[model samples]
Target: MQIFEAIIGHVEKRCEAKGKRLTTQRKLVLRALIDANQALSAYELVDYCKQYFGETIQAMSVYRILEFLEEVHLVHKLNMSNKYIVCSHIVEGHEQGIPQFLICSKCNKISEKIVAPETITGLQSHARQEGFTVVSPQLEINCVCDKCGQ
Candidate 1:
């Protein structure tokens, strides 16, 4: 609980730094994600808000809030699963690099990592050779977590 509050504070400060306000609705959405501690689809988030807060939040509103959170680097969207997770580095106050997500296929648990810049450069180079452009630097790898693997 202490850690969650700290993360929320950090995110609030970050948003303020960008001249943006983390409104109550946004905080509720963020809290839902933090409490779940896993990637969640916008619809799932809406259900969470309804279940936990007894508040009705539209999926479209959740998506817009998520977009704002992503813009502030407080959340990340997993392209592979079309789910959103709070950024892992928020509490650490670390500068973000290109994010890569290791997703547990069975449980949908996600581990976020910052890939080495050189590795991303190599991938971009390879893509360029194929006459392709790298649109987003985020990468998602599907795997089974140790517990699930066992």
Candidate 2:
């Protein structure tokens, strides 16, 4: 939570090293995601970008940047709701580890937890025992919050 700035800095450095232009729009979008504790959809991101950045920021451009961010592990795409969230870790590549999403369907609050290597191994072993190959850990658990229950 307190280390988003460090992650953004590292990402910027990586982009620089790769000779990729760290465009203003890209920075803004990533920053918005970093600032938002909850996952945001592209539409939400586009709206925020347009509001804070003015009308010059096109939705298509936002989508493109979001896709690139997702590709590079700077962000993770939530399959349950088709939203995007900044990765819990600033990993170099996207598909290195199994990402477990703790999502609340009622309030739409999302928390990401990275599966340890051993946990993954155990999961794989269990899957193998069941004659099934585990692919992804995109978990979306539905529940009612305390406030909502009251």
Candidate 3:
């Protein structure tokens, strides 16, 4: 299996700094997400772990890990697809702009993009004008990727 030692190390440090423990199963789960080209559901991650590591992981366990990772910003949950993908900015630590996802409906591939501050400000401004509270700044756009489009 491909290894992401650097990313794992960064996550380990981040988890420790946040007073959270990154368990072995959690690390493997993150690695599975990192290795995947598309978003994967918790069940899919269990299958991947069994296939690659010859280890059986329960879907519940994976779900818990995904929750923890999402809480720490090490992963992002795609609500539309019910799948999870690793955060692309993990290696860079904290990022400047909010992260937006371009999800390919055909292939389930997710590409990460940073929404410009101005655009986010505009969105917030519009929401304020409408008297709606901004819960989260993240955005997900549905589209076909180049590979799937062609």
Candidate 4:
């Protein structure tokens, strides 16, 4: 994918398969995720929501929708920041893999990098050996990008 968005063809197939409604609120939330191009806390999402979804939607409503989207693998949440972002690859065709987050500490921009299947498998196996099953490795580190470093 180019970044944070659904390939419309793929998303439509998924929605049909799941029998889920892509309500206006869901579209609004997804748009905000795409536009922000970063992990966004629900509160931040709500701030954007007011513009299109109106003041009627409480934060909890947004959270509920986000929760549903995540459960269905339409979006992924980075627990490190307790924020959500659109998955780079929207389809989880084969019980696939967790998407890794490349987050900028200085500007808070995020880039989703698809971890290789071998890497995820090895990590999961290692975690299982330690009696811990790791779900997200959206690691946050302190560093500046070349532009920021300059």
Scored by CA lDDT, what does every candidate get? 0.90, 0.75, 0.86, 0.73
lDDT of 3 by residue, 1-150 (tens): 425987788779988988999999999898888877568999999999999888888999999999999988888888777889888888776743688998878877778988999999999999999999788888999999999989
lDDT comparison, 2 vs 3, better candidate? 3
lDDT of 4 by residue, 1-150 (tens): 354345545665687777977676776787777776677889999997777447456798889989987877778887767889887666555553556776767887677676787887887799899999776654444456666667
* Tens digit per residue, CA lDDT, model 1, 1-150: 787788789888887877999999999999999998888999999999999889999999999999998988889998887889999887665668999889989998888889999999999999999999999978999999999999
TM-score quality measure for candidate 2: 0.72
Question: Which model scores highest in TM-score?
Answer: 1
Where does candidate 2 have its weakest 10-residue lDDT segment? 88-97
Candidate 2 accuracy as lDDT: 0.75
What TM-score would you give candidate 4 relative to the actual structure? 0.76
After superposition, candidate 2 runs with Cα above 4 Å error: 1-7, 17-20, 91-96, 122-135, 143-150
Model 4 RMSD in Å is 3.8
In model 3, where do residues sit more than 4 Å from their true spots? 1-3
The candidate that wins on lDDT is 1
Q: Which ten residues in a row have the lowest lDDT in candidate 1?
A: 87-96
Score residue 115 of candidate 3 by CA lDDT: 94
